[model samples]
Target: MKGRTKLTGLVIFRGDPGYEAARKNWDPHTDRFPKVFVFAQRTQDVSNAIKWARENKVPIRPRSGRHSLEVNLSQVNGGLVIDTTKLNQIKLNKKAGTVVVGTGNRVGRIANTLAKQGFIAPFGDSPTVGIGGITPGGGIGPLQRSIGLISDNLLALEMVDAKGKVIRANSKCNSDLLWATRGGGGGNFGVYTKYKFKVHPAPAKATVYRITWPWAQFEEVLKAWQRWAPFVNNKLGSELSIGPKKGGNVSMEGLFLGSKTEALRLLKPVTSVGTPTSSIIRLLPYTEAVKFLLPPDPILTQRESNQFSSGFGRKPFTNKAIKAMRQFLENVEGQFAGFFFLNWGGAVSRKSPRSTAFYWRDAQFYVEWNSSWLKPSAAPRNIAIVRQTRRKLQPYIVGSYINVPDQGIKNSGPVYYGANFPRLRRVKAKYDPKNIFNNPQSIPPANHKR
Candidate 1:
């Protein structure tokens, strides 16, 4: 392990020329330096890294896109980092309606690559998000309402477990592992190497729409959206973002798996509530539509920093809760703060809670409280805004979304897994009893506490 000449992938030690660059995370806020960085080129390299860490009595962290909000969960000081970004390989079984993707593949790349072959898989809005991180946490995207979460379509996957053993999980074998992976979130069971997902034929064409209302009308819009978006139509998926009233605005945007006319007809309820300041509606090919939904940092080649907390709403917001939300948006101390409501019903609710580890299947929509800052001194105020908003909406929300990891949350085990927490603990004990794959928020073994 000293020279790393026998390792398949390049290994960098502290003070190495490239170590500084390799240790940085996608989030600028995450400042952690590992003793060694392994840019794993193949599945075997991941196993080697884990084995090396165990032998050396050093902790190890597995990383792919490096987008975890709680960055420390995927990184540790003076430990070993197993980076799987170089394991990117995609194989398509077009006839079987399936695609095998490497864990390092990004969401945007996955969409574009599969669309070319007239097939696609459900993925989140961020083009830079790694399939490895999102799939295990229940990937929600534009097509989610119509099809289902990315986890719902996961057919099989390969992983390097805590014992350095490569294992495959699917319906026929290691089914319990498969059940735990779907919506159980990452950094729990093991390091995922590859995922084979059941794909659907790309929609010939899709429509996208964006509508904005003045800050003064934010309350009205929120009320209407909460009552409508989730149940609007199976073919339409939408999200509402309401920025701080102090220098921010409110907007709604989403994609529809139908023609422009159909999208317009279904959007009448939203458009009728208030006169929008601006509106843009377009019909484009499936791939183009998917690309349009990409986040600000589409490729994630650069670092972005932010803080946020998310939860699921089983029912519409109460009038009191809506007022609290409006008051918080209007009076929040920070300027770069907002609340997001993402549609979350249709096919998502069709599955029972126990079918998969994803616990909030019956939720109508999910809520995310977000805040950002430019300086360390400015972080606390912005962070407070997010926590306060969560407190305001606490009574109306259920479990939290594991995808948006939040360190501020207490009782994370129950909040993230709900009734499935117990089963997830069992899975953790089975595959990672020694807790080689772990983090502050990671699922613990049968009797351990968070």
Candidate 2:
């Protein structure tokens, strides 16, 4: 146990006073009882923890924001958890139009902080997700079409490799590593310490709107939204949702980076579909729009048992695809079950597929479904519903999103990375040939066989 003396930061063993609290993740379904948790306060601490885990032959899992949705991704039984939540830091350089941020910061804090300085960076929907995990997974949200993905803005990063060595990657040095990390997913390469991003100034005012329709109009509204959202003005980003018959309705909410008049004109296609039950549109400052578009800051310790799966839509849904969606909504039985959709293209499609590890650049829209329950006994039924729905829509969807992972996927490499899977494997082999950083679906070295 000589390596134990070498570990630094706040170490909590299994039987320690805070072990009970330290073992939890955002989703109760993914929680595990790890042997120890090392809250790394600095990059050196992360390097020390990785070396200690190797010396003791213990598995290692890197954690930030505690928001990993899948089991064993951020915590493992009888293993070590290296947490980077303490590495939170934000530095903005107005002259250079860039920002260097610690990977430990949450999405909400970064958005709020940047908005205060009259700047904006791409962000996902949930404010609680860590930048460390999201950036590598091709972060997408309301600002995606306008500013590109969070990964696209990533200019450089610092990481601690499997051999407990610190490394830097950017356009000039370790450039291939930088390319792969942009959208290759987290915990596959190494423990990222910091990210240097190219940021943009926020618009003076933006328009935010929310429109809803009766349950019966779900199919009509969906068809209209799918056709219009992706082709609408690039400055406008929209999301559509449909839920079960028991508690959900068809709704669309979004942000338009312009005056309300321009937003209404561009929204004519979908907004003109059916008689809407309600409509709310307002012009607000950029910061206010951020608050309106994103969900409220989350309670980190709040937990729920849930199953989620996602795919990219290369084109508008066919009639059969729409029918299948209707059937799922009509039959699903859960208080928290539904489908979520976001328009793709615009700046996202401007980048070639091979330019980065995120190869779904041609996707016209992105769709995902989730089933959640509070009771342990309800897990099977809820999980089955999502799996079944995925199968029915498989023909129409191209690939799955790594961020919204589904354990049911047997061969996940191609499903998540597409044609870029081979290149990613080569990069993995070069930096982590020993395969020290891995999870259930993590990329394996090219020399190793599945």
Candidate 3:
């Protein structure tokens, strides 16, 4: 492995120009530099990278999207990166409501392509996010409650393990592999190349709504909305995003899945909370509604958004919790922070948690606190805010969605996976006993040494 030809499949060493861009994800706060990167175009390429790194006794860090907040990439400083963005390929069987896509494929491409066939994959909130990272990590979105988490639709997977063996896993084959990949989160096992998943007949037409609440009513609306959210009908979905408004005000951003007429009827409690300064709700294609919550256009956003770890609440946030949220909001500077409450409980939780590796099966609400700032100097404060919020909400968290990982700083594996920790650890021990795939928040094997 001394010269260029000595290494395997599409290697780029320390000086390669592509190495810089290939090493980083979208999170601007991280500063990681791996020894080399393999712009793998096929499974063999991924295998080669893994084999080379392991033989040399170097750790391997896998990156798919630009969304990983944790420093998973940073660990590759003297190791290797199996860059799979080039392995993108989508094999669709539209009639069967199924798709076999390369893990590198983004949510936007999947959604747009599926739209043509009158079917659609549950795209991640961001168009740029890669399926490799999201599908395995348990994705959430407007369509999540309506259809289900992206992992719920996963039917099979093609993976390259730490041993560099190419294996295909499905229910009839490697069922344990399928279960671990669904929600065990990334880097706990190996690199996933492709995924076989179930798609849904998307609504021919859909609707979206945007409502802004006045700053003065933040406390009242925050508490009441959480209570009203879990009780809403299965077909309807709403999110109460609380953020500082212009001129030091506060706002609530929402998304609903129905016509203006029906949406109004369903959102009466929300409308009654505060006199919306700006109210806009209208019908559109299912595609359009999906895009509403995740606009491509840049708006006022936190620059250095910190880690977002989430958990499910059994009931609406209590008065004490609501007051704490309000107090936190009161302290956050208008320019750089916000707390988001995505309402849940729909067709999603109707199924048992045991159905998938994802443990938050009975959760009614999802909470994410993000601190957004424009400068590099802002990261410490942002990270602190996220930590404080997690401490405050610890009691209310029943189970967690793995994708929104807080890296390696959590109290214990039990804090993240609830009752599923023991099982997940067992699965880790069984499949990745060598611990070839590990990062900050990954599940350690039963016989873990460090």
Candidate 4:
């Protein structure tokens, strides 16, 4: 028994066969195989691992959903990886309209569970994305316009500090940590074992609209979408997608949160912009909406190229910006890919900028100039496309999304947290001064000079 239960969790060394599974992440681009993966089964196990890593001075990487864009949080060459996937448990409170979720749960599973009870949680575009990671990174998804980002709905969080002590944060206790947890990227302060969400009743049915436009008419559709996209109805969650599709054509995809009849009426202005190659709009059960927005978890060797930048749109896309977008869309080789634009109003903007650590309160749209490189050699070319596209649209953009960062910027503290970076640094130093929660993106202890 001396050797057993050294930690309250299952600890596997470098040669363990299970290490292969624990080392991998969702993104197929980079392969990160950590030397040791401590599968934390409980909060006590998490605390034990923290003390071990601290004494050994091992660089620690925290993970739950491993749905990370950058390889930092998922891989640490020879260091220890504290895996929270095993802490899979959920405690629901229907009366409070909240649920404390295990970090291990993915958006799809959580959404399905909650939807059964007529409740919905804010999730990312991918259903497989973990709630642990997205909740802290200012999660925005199909329901953002209705319930707002996942952060907005966050009521409290339970985290294990760098010193192996567990604490809960919210408006009442550890208010600063609460602020940092809202919009600041996760895995910084400590290992978040659970998240309490303020969920809401979902619509009985949602309407999704898909309209494809030819490559030849990209400019006209692009110009018109820029004008009408930001000012749409608050209840109507909308987005305009311009990207490569099958047969070398561009696609314009959109989603609305109301009846198909009302959606058709709301989309009249959009249809008038240009003739869609194929337009389809309909109302379906709230659960079916998941298929249209985020298809079921399909196992594929998928590679994503996201220049994770963000921008706010206070006014309509100007002629200059629209013309610039047209030029960039026309410049692409038009392969099988996509450029996405998500609406930022409705419930998303209801909270003020300073309400939580996340900024971009008044901004109306989040432009994710993302691409998918199916092949290895295509990575460089795809990156260049991202740069060129953003360069053309930079004037009209403001900030970037941490979920899909460019990887070029070193000071991600500013890029990811924006105005909230400084406070985040202080929080990191206060709770994790020893830097037990160390990773490339984890908040660096701010006490170095203080």
Name the candidate that leads on lDDT.
2
Q: CA lDDT, every prediction?
A: 0.84, 0.89, 0.73, 0.72
Better of 1 and 3 by lDDT: 1
Give the candidates in order of lDDT, highest first. Answer: 2, 1, 3, 4
Best-fitting candidate, measured by TM-score?
A: 2
Candidate 1 residues lying further than 4 Å off, grouped into runs, are 1-7, 295-304, 331-336
The TM-score ranking, best first, is 2, 1, 3, 4
TM-score computed on alpha carbons, candidate 2: 0.97
Structural similarity to truth (TM-score) of each candidate: 0.95, 0.97, 0.92, 0.89
Could you give candidate 2's per-residue lDDT for residues 1-450 as a string of tens digits?
755538899999999999998987888889999989999899999999999999998999998888887788999899899999889999999999999999888888898889889998777778889998999999988888988999999999999999999999999999999999888999998999999999999998899999998878888888888888889989899998887787888889989999999999988888898888899899999899888877686576654677899999988899898888877788776665788999998999999999999999999999998887788998888888889888999999998989888988988999999999999999999999999998899999998986
Q: What is candidate 1's TM-score against the reference?
A: 0.95
For residues 1-450, write the lDDT of model 3, one tens digit per residue: 542323566788888877765655566565477788787888888887887888787789777766676665434577787777787888888678799998877777787778767785786557777788888777777677788878888999999988888989999988887987777687787889989999888777766777787777777877778778877766666766777543344454445555668878887887787677888777878767666656663321224555565677888777777766666676666353666677677767876766667777777788776656566676677667767877787777665666666753454577666667777788888778988888766788888865
Give per-residue lDDT, candidate 3, residue 395.
77
Model 3 clash tally, residue pairs? 4
Model 4 TM-score, all chains together: 0.89
- C-alpha root-mean-square deviation, candidate 3: 2.7
Instruction: Report the candidate with higher lDDT, 2 versus 4.
Output: 2
User: Per-residue CA lDDT of candidate 4, range 35-145, in tens?
Assistant: 678888888988887777766666777777777776566667877777787777777788988898888788888887777777776666788887888888888765687
RMSD of 1: 2.1
lDDT of 2: 0.89
